[model samples]
Structure formats: structure tokens, C-alpha cells
Target: MNDEINYTNNPLHGLGLQELLTQIVDHYGFEILYAYLNINCFKTNPSIESSVKFLKKTEWAREKVEIFYLYQYKNLPRVSSEQFELPPRKRIIPEGQTPREPAELSFEDAERVREKQAKKAAEHGKSKRYKEREFENLWKR
Candidate 1:
């Protein structure tokens, strides 16, 4: 079976690093980028060429810029504390849409939700403890 990854929903797919830098620079300009990223490329004699060079060499700085693009510029829905953390590829894209407000829950529904969360937490703790034990056993061998 042939499987292909579809990037239709991904905002960062077609865009190159240079293009990303240029778009961000066009939208926010170098001074604002400098304020947000606080990188030397944006602060000192800033240019698209220089910033791209810096971002290419620095992984952390590149991630920051990409995150800024996703959250600030693209305005994707903010991740909720309760939801499982997802990587960029796994996250749902909002495509310029406003985030929907969470629905109000009744007392019973709220209690149920809390119980569910506690159960999930307990399960996660068990798995973590099991992994630690496994690692300890491996070291003893």
C-alpha cells in the first residue's frame, strides 16, 4: 500500500525559509521582529538576507520565528491546558477563523469532566512509573 502525506492543511508546507522571513519582515518589519525575537540578525543591520542566514544556522531562533508566525501572524487557536499537546503537523489549523468559546457546563457535567481528567492523569502516572521501573531493571541486568 502506498501512503502519501497531505500538507493541504499545513500553513508552513509550501513556504521556504527565505519566503517565511520575507513575509514576516513585510508584515511586521525588522524592528518589530527584533523586539519579538531579540535576535542579532534583526537588531543589527537587519536584512532579509542576513536574517535568513542567521535563522538557517540557528535551530532555536528558527523555531521561535515559526512559532511567532503560527501564533501571532496566523492567529491559530491557542492550545488549551486540558488538551493533549500536539506537534505542528498533528494540530488542527483554524485557517483565519476565530476560536469558538467553550460551552458552559452544568454541575453534573463539570463533575464528570473532572472525574475523567483525574482518571486520565492516574493512567498516565501509572505508565510513567512502569517505564521508570523498566529502566531500573535494564540497568541492574
Candidate 2:
């Protein structure tokens, strides 16, 4: 009979809103925890201690806190992996157009590409693009 109200055999034994909020804040900083929860407690001008008091009175806030705890901390059933995996779709390449396979880049080819990129970056850096732009602005002043 007691099982009807609570989770498992102990419905009356769940942690309240304050407890859940405290745990979340302890794990993640107050700012981040508040951002994710999006409750008035964290958003209010007062600090976490004060916010806890305000949150305790609000039934809706308490419910959300409890739900998040139950879902994440309490090991609730997860959605099936199948939900994330996309179904296979047909690839349609035009018959007349040849689909070019990617060029097999050897180790030498990769090293050459890297060296070229490094040289390009060095040239760009030496150009002092920022200094050029700042000089124009400074002269305009």
C-alpha cells in the first residue's frame, strides 16, 4: 500500500527540492546549475542560500527540481539507442557524373601540405595585419 505513493518501496523517502538543488550546485557551480535549471531561485538577486528559501515555497519549482534529480541522479530508464541512430538512406549519384574517390594522400603528401600551411601562416603573421588596421584607425583619430 505504501509503495503506491513513492518510488519503489519507499515513496516517502525521496530527497526534497532543497536537497536536489544543493546537490546540483555542489556538483556544478551556482551559475551553471541555475542556467541549466532556469529557476527563479538562482536568477533572483539574492545568493544561493537565499534562493534555496524561495525555491522551497514554490511547488512548481520543487517539482522540476525533483524531476531532474529523478531523471539524472536517480538512474531513471534511458531512451533507447535506436532513437539516435539514423536509418539507412539511399545515395543517389548521377549515372553520367563519375563520383571521384578521394585522392590517396601519402605520408609525404601530408608532410608537404603541413609545411605549405605553416609557411602560409608565417607569411600572414609577418604581414602584421592587425598593426596595419590599427594604424589606419589611429591616423583617422
Candidate 3:
């Protein structure tokens, strides 16, 4: 049985960089994008043309924007890690899964997300140090 996943259903499949950027900018604006994405292109002198040009030249940033477009703007369900390895344009949406309404986002919500991420990172760092100290103590005994 053939198990090929059809990617044509993805909204990003044939969408141009300019068009994608324009849609998000129209809905969310550059300020909200910068707050959530932290991309300099969106933050500094942001414009649809400038952002599209920058994203065209930059692979990582383009991928980031595409991902934000899929997960946040299109409100698609999160993909499995294997599927996520593919670009958002190529990732396969499971059968019966369709895009939903764009998420309601705000600058304040972005700030809260950043704070939560920072807290998680600090906790991870503390645990790593504790583990290292424990390892050293085990060797010294």
C-alpha cells in the first residue's frame, strides 16, 4: 500500500513569501510579530517588502516565519518530530485535520511566553549544575 503524504493541502505549499508576509502583517502587524518571533527584520524598520526580501535571503528566518504562520496563524495542530523536520510547507497534516482560525495574540501574551521560557531555561540550568556537583561528589567519595 502506498503511504505517501499529500502536501498540497498545506496552505504554504504554493504561497509566495510576499503574500504570506502580507497576510500575517495585515492581521497581526509587525509589532506583534517581532514580539513573538524576535526577528530583527520584523522589529527594525519593518515593511512587507523588506521582510520578504530578508526572508528570501535567509533560510532559518524564513523557516521560522513559515512555522509561525502554520502553527499560530493557521492554527494547525503540532506535528510529530519526524514531520516537523520537514519545512512547514512540506510537512504533512494528518487526515481530518484542517486549519482553524488564527490564534488571538497580543504583545502582552508574547511577553508572558518569553517569561515562561526563561523560567524553564533557568530551572534546567540549575538542575544541570546540581547533577554535575553530584557527579563530582560521587567521584571524590
Using lDDT as the measure, the top candidate is 3
TM-score versus the correct structure, for each prediction: 0.56, 0.42, 0.79
Worst 10 residues of 3 by lDDT: 132-141
Ranking by TM-score: 3, 1, 2
Q: Is candidate 2 or candidate 3 better by lDDT?
A: 3
lDDT of 3: 0.75
lDDT comparison, 1 vs 3, better candidate: 3
Clashes of each: 0, 1, 0
Report the alpha-carbon TM-score of model 1 versus the true structure: 0.56
Each prediction's whole-model lDDT (CA): 0.57, 0.42, 0.75
Which digits, one per residue and each the tens of the lDDT, describe model 2 over residues 1-141? Answer: 532332332211454545666665665555553543456667666365676687668655654454344333332332223411211111121223331222232345435544554565566674544333222222111
RMSD of each: 14.1, 22.3, 10.0
lDDT measured at residue 31 in model 3 versus the true structure, 0 to 100: 94
Between the candidate structures 2 and 3, which one is better when assessed by TM-score? 3
